[model samples]
Target chain A: MTQPQSRIRRSFGDLSERALAFWLLVPAALLLGLVALYPVGRLLYTSLFRRRLTDETGNSPVFVGFQNFVQAFSDERFWTALWNTLLIVLVTVPGALVVGLLLALLANLPFRVKWPIRLGLLLPWALPLVFAGLIFRWFFDSQYGVINDVIVRLGGERLLWVTTPELLFWAICLSIIWKSSSFVALILLAGLQVIPKELYESAAVDGANRWQSFWRITLPLLIPAILVAAIFRTITAFQTFDIPFAMQNGGSSFETLAMYVRTMSIENLNFGYGSALAVLMFLISFVVTLVYLRYVRGADD
Target chain B: MKKLFWLLVAVLLASTALAQQTRLRVFVGGQQRPDVMRKIFDLYQSRNPGVRVDVEVGGATSDQQQQYLTTVLASRDPSIDVILIDVIRPAQYLASRWADTIDKYLPAASRQELLRRYLPAYSQANVINGQLVALPAFADAMFLYYRADLLEKYGFKPPTTWDEAIQQAQTILQREGNPNLNGIGFIGAPAEGTVCTFLLPIWAAGGDVTNAQGQFSLTVEQAQRALQFWVGLMDQKVSPPNMAEKPQDTIRSEMQAGRWVFGTLFAYAWNRFQNDADSQVKGKIGVVPLPAFAGGRQASCLGGWQWTVSDFSRNKAQAHRLVRFLSSPEVSKILAIEASNLPVFPALYRDADILKVNPWFGQALPVVQAARARPQHPRYAEISEAIRVTTNQVLARQKTPEQGAREIVTRLQAIYGGR
Candidate 1:
């Protein structure tokens, strides 16, 4: 056993550092390629062709080059969906961050039983996206919805929360904020815990008020965590599907980019156009990620 | 220890026996009650002791089920041997080669006989490209539901035309003096039901969506007129202001709670209105053919489910047998009586037993006979989305009727032109 073990060690030692590193990375690189790179590569390839899954002729996909991309650019629904996705990201990311920060601060308060508040913060995060959407859909329902009921009870005229597009947009944003803020709060809470309570103590000794200390110390230190949360929220917001889809069932006026992809690929069986749309969505997300990474690097500097 | 050893040996023997038996999975949508389906499968299992039929229930709505099935079928998943699909999906399924043709399973005589036995609309939907793709599991069509007690109280007969219906609704709303009550309700949301809603008025006005050559034939004027009527309903308060948000279930629930004087819904609503515990419209609901345009005949949108064996199924022969058995006339009668699903066979529609359980089905037969299927195209889903989305815009007052009509024409022209 000892001789075999030493022989194995000697063989491994024969490998140079670079070769060892390459060998070490082979499994992870292959895994990443299989899980991530292959689907995206296939999507890129599919985007360049005209393929209909339901075509009765059994014809192979015809090479269409950039025609699908051109069609997407000219499609009015595509633009509307892109705008809706962007609007959702713009409205919901900051909304979640602000609300999440408040919740995180409250949960981090020196309370006797932190578990209840922590669990309260976790409940919305743990709820399924589709379930959250359905719950909010009911909440904003025009007739028997809780929102309308409360408004009527308060002597305010009942507003059509869902039927009206603008109202539905706001309602969706609010629901997304409610659903995602807990996750943001959890992340920020971790940052808060690592915050070194001694800094706040020193600030107090330096005659700093609670708000002053929070603004000067907590806010500055929390920036990295906030940026991380924002990046995640922004990416997810771009792929917003479940909430809006559950609320409106892919109504044209409120359709998101992801919903449009589903309508094209799955509903219409037009994989070519759907893939083009997906690639466009991916490019937008990639650019946004790059921007966020740059901002994170600048903050680190 | 010896007793334990004997028990283990017995368990192993039973496991081997079970493994030898064939297991088939049948996927049905939520609309088809799985419990009722399970009972039917149990009957099949009793006769074929070597086989086990397991029921898998899918999504609640047609669109949801379509999406789920599309993903599964596209991947050629063989786990599900049989599937229950919407009436509109047979063409798509056949074109995609997801559904196995029944021609090989049935002799020419039996196939023709089976086709002749089912309702014409369903027969037309199931047979595509001279191939029998599916068998009708049940029949459904849109019906105009009203409060029988209220119409009688007001000494009025059911209106047979749109104008008359609108006039009656106005008078009833004014007289009822109930703020909670609305005149009429139909699906105006951008859902699968909205496609039927959009086509109803056009079909009633004698406008065909597709020509005999299977080309897109809807005229801009026809579309405009249909939109105008629906928009007029919302503008004149015949329908609720938020009608654009109401799906079929919402409309059903509202009508069941006695909030709407008139509702456009499918055959299934009759069973719910009369039997559901929360139903306030029990014993007071009246079913009628949907109203037509003044110069045209009445038309209902044909709706139903069909059973098809998956082409990728490992147990193709057994799956085909199960489908045929499930769609047999005897099973149809049982479904009609027990679940209130309309029978696909015309003879069962007139069956004494079915009539005894579902009296309204007698009235529904004429409507079912006259009902029209939506445009039959492999890309019908795209066509449906274009029309429903445009109609929704008109109903929501986001677009004028002319704009909506023009949009529909443009979108449909592109879809047809692309092909």
Candidate 2:
């Protein structure tokens, strides 16, 4: 008994700070494993099996390894969804960033209506996705839509903003920009507020123009904020679902990767294929984010 | 005074806990006739004070509600005592054997009454493999709402075939001479509405997604023909170009805006088409059965909701009672009139009160009698997506009729293994 007690005391004495931290973090780590790691592991494992929600053969999964991936690769919908997702990311990220930067710059200025403008900026992000989608849908309505009415009043043709696939794609982009740019603007504005006024005063003392100062001082200092905003916007645009889903109702041409996962899983009830698609989506986003971070790190160096 | 207040609070909390034990949770779509549902639930509560029903209204759309129900049933969850099932959901439920059978839980008298009074299609459709999986709750069928004044002005009878429909539409478009006015409108948006509208003529032509012979009888060719015929309306400029992406509501609004000579809509549209204050065609509209392909049988796609007790439910008895109460003749009549539901009970068709409220249902009878239910496959959702995609493709002019039909065949075969 004395030997065991002495061993316990030695073990306690052997606890390094890092070891103590590791022991203390064990619960949280296990919790993360249970919540995040488990679902991901299960999703990966489930993807290897033929598991139908309404599997008449009892809920036992029949293993069909890699067939789901093969099926997905062969499927036309998969390709369409991938391309659409890429298109949305490519288009919306830049569109939102530019607009957000402009808005942030305007918001940084000493305008009398700054508060009202800020409130208006916050409104899109504050409104729920469905409500914002509905508003945009109405505004772009082919008949009696405010936008259409404006166009018609200007003696232009009343376009099928929500009907035609091409137009619907643009409309979805418009709504996404409408909803997300506000968030980006808010982020950039915080970054803009932190920039020292003395740098701008010094630049002014040195006879640098406003545009030159903005390009030379504001943008360089704002790079970290821009990266953060871009990364956030990029991830969101990659997983484009609600706006397109609400605005265009998943038009055949505009099925995003997220929508494809949903169509396969929820709508088709083919959980195995859906899981494979979801895993693939996660992988794509992971790789893109890694590449992005590498590029950012390289640029920094 | 503080001690007395605490004692009163304790009593209230104790009673509330007891009340919670007996509460039955129900899954109801909030979007569908909620006021009428509330009224009926209120009536039930007033009658049965001991039991409490907690209606969890959810999902803006029936599809979303179906998804919620699917998730609940996937885990064999017992929390939802009674679920309001879309007409197509029973097959999925029955495949999993998740929902309790009404025949087992319902009282003998109420079960017998339901059997005797329920409409044949509904009664038959609610059963799976000879087991009564659910009870008929309400009825819905597609109705063709036509401009009576325009048809009369154009000296045409309501077109009884797709061929005739196109011709009539073109003539009306030319004669109406209003650029804004189109020949026809339909819920052609690639949704469940599109699936229902697109299938109406094909079904009337004795075509189906699958036939009674346990074979994939619906050829891509037939589906293609249906698609071609639908697309012909757009091609001929008879139906407005905008109609291709319009939902039933948009179609109805367009009709009310007096821009169409004919429109296809649900049973709920009858009242609004005839009576709504904003309606442009009120009192000037006539109803007809959806015209078939030439020399084919008449058809209207069966659409409605069903009520089933969840198998895992702890309060199955209360759920049965609620189902029985909802299906009773009096409540059903109220449902039919106030909610504008097409009653699934055969006896209520001739009810004076129902007729007084829905005069157009007189025309709705023959159509209801001939309604065609979508194939009740366990994989019905997949079958429906296939239909929606194929129809949308054809309507959008992305594929030829033959191509769309072939695509449908390919899609179905991919899912069902083409036995």
Candidate 3:
């Protein structure tokens, strides 16, 4: 055992620093390839075929090239699902950001007992997405829902929060904002904590007002954290499934891309088409991430 | 030395017992009452001591169960020996070879006898391409549930035609000036139940989504007229304005709360309406065959579960025995009396024990006999999605009846492509 251990140490010592670094990275690189790259590569490969799991003939997957992608382009349902997903991201990301910023500011206030406020901020984020969806689904029920009850008490006409497509869309967005804003706030709060207390003290000495300090100091210093939060939230919003599914079981008029993928791949057993749709979704997310990274770099400069 | 010897003997005996036992896993949906099924399994085990049966309960809803079973079967997993499937799934399962044909287990004569025992509609659903693919575990059909007291108070009989039903509902609503009370309730939500909602009117109009040749051949005019009838109900305020969002459970609860004079629901709701502690409509409920379109025939959408032996099961012979045992008339009667599951055997409907426990089942037999299965194509799921989604859109006022009808035809035509 001693001889083998000495030999291994000598071999590692023999390598140059750069070479040693590369050698050390081999295991991690292999793991990344297995966990991340393999599934994506398989998705791409499957997207190029015509494969139905239920085909009785037991025929092997036939090469269809880009036909699945072509079909998705012309498929009206596919376009509707894509539009729904984009609308969700566009609306919910900004909605969560603004709400999250306010929450972060409030929580950042000098309270003697900070843990309780932080814990309160965490409660919504910690709740399961499906649970949040179900709670809100009841809240929006047109007949016996609490929202309608309140409105009726206030002398307002009852609105159909779930039956109408526009209202259902807003209801889902509201739920998403409620669940995700806490996560954004927690991130933003961390960013706030890292800012030097002396900077704020010095700003106060210069006679800057509170609002001015928030705008000129806190907001500017919080960009990196905000960008990080936006990146996570935007990607998650693109993959919105549980909330919409629990609310309406992916109703046709309000279906997101992820839900459509599930309908095709799992429900219809049409793997090829579903994979193509999934690949398209991945490309959109990838491009958005690239743009955000570019913006982050620009902001740093 | 004697104690050590006995210990060795016990270990040897345990190994032999373990080796002798053959475990069979049966997958049933949550709605099937797996707890009750476990009792039946116990009986089977006692009869066949060498076989140890295990129960795996699946999702509550048909859609969820289908997704779970599809994933399991597609992988050709042998873990599930016997599968309980929705009534509409035999064709798809058989076509995919996920289910083993029953002919191998039962001879033609015995299979014919077995099929004859079941209701005709069930036999029609289970037998595909001249082969028996499954056995019905129970029977179900959509029924028009009404408030008996309310209908009597208004001096109206159960409406037999869609037109009469609407007219009676309107008059009742106008007379009973309760703002909270609605005329009728039915599922218009985008759920598996909506498929039946979409098909019910067209079927009542003597039209079908598929022709006898199993091709897409929906009559566009019939579909349009059927859809317009539903939209008219909303426009006339015979149904609630938010009908499009109500699912089967929601409709059931609303009806049970005495919010509606009439509702259309499945056979299972009878149990809840009568027995659930919170039910307000108890002792005042009446069920009838769903109303027909004028000049057309009455039709109910067939809904039930069936037992199938998994093709990948290692012990197919034992699985066949278990399925046959579970689907027999004797066991069917037990399920009917114990769980309120409608028996697949027509004779069981008249059985004194079952009728005593569920008197409404007497009315159910005729409705069940007249019930029709949804299209039996392998792509039935997609077909159902198209119809239900379009129906939801029409009910939600996103599309005109004509647009919805044409879209269904177009979508089905595309799906059937060159067939």
Give the best candidate by TM-score. 3
- The digit string of per-residue lDDT tens for model 3 on B1-419 reads 99999999999999999899999999999988898899999999999999999999998888888888888887899999999999989988877789998899777898888788889988989998998999999988899999899889989999999788889899999999998789878889888888888888888777888778876678789789878888889898899778778878888988888888899899888888999999999999999999988888999989988999999999999899889998898789878987899899888888898889898888889889889888887777888888888888898787899999998888888778722
TM-score list, all predictions: 0.93, 0.88, 0.94
**lDDT at position A195, candidate 2:** 97
The best-first sequence of candidates by lDDT reads 1, 3, 2
> Best DockQ goes to which candidate?
1
- Candidate 1 lDDT tens digits, A1-301: 6999898678888898999889889999999999999999999999999889778332478998999999999998899999889899999999999999999999999999889999999999999999999999889987879999999999999888776778989999999999999999999999898999899999999999999999999999998899899998998999999998888756756899999998899889999989999999999999989988899789779
DockQ of 2: 0.40
Root-mean-square deviation (CA) per prediction: 2.9, 5.2, 2.7
Task: Assess candidate 2 and give its lDDT.
Answer: 0.81
Of the two candidates 2 and 3, the one with more favorable lDDT, higher being better, is: 3
Residue-level lDDT of model 2, residues B163-253, one tens digit each, is 7888988887877688878777887776777888767768877788776866767776677777877777888888766665677777787
Per-candidate DockQ values are: 0.62, 0.40, 0.58
Write down the worst ten-residue block by lDDT for model 2 chain A: A245-254
User: Each prediction's Cα lDDT score?
Assistant: 0.90, 0.81, 0.89
- For A207-247, candidate 3 gives per-residue lDDT tens digits of 99999998999999998999899999998999999898888
Docking level of model 3 = medium
Candidate 2 Cα outliers beyond 4 Å, as residue runs: A1-35, A150-155, A289-301, B1-21, B46-49, B106-116, B152-157, B162-176, B274-277
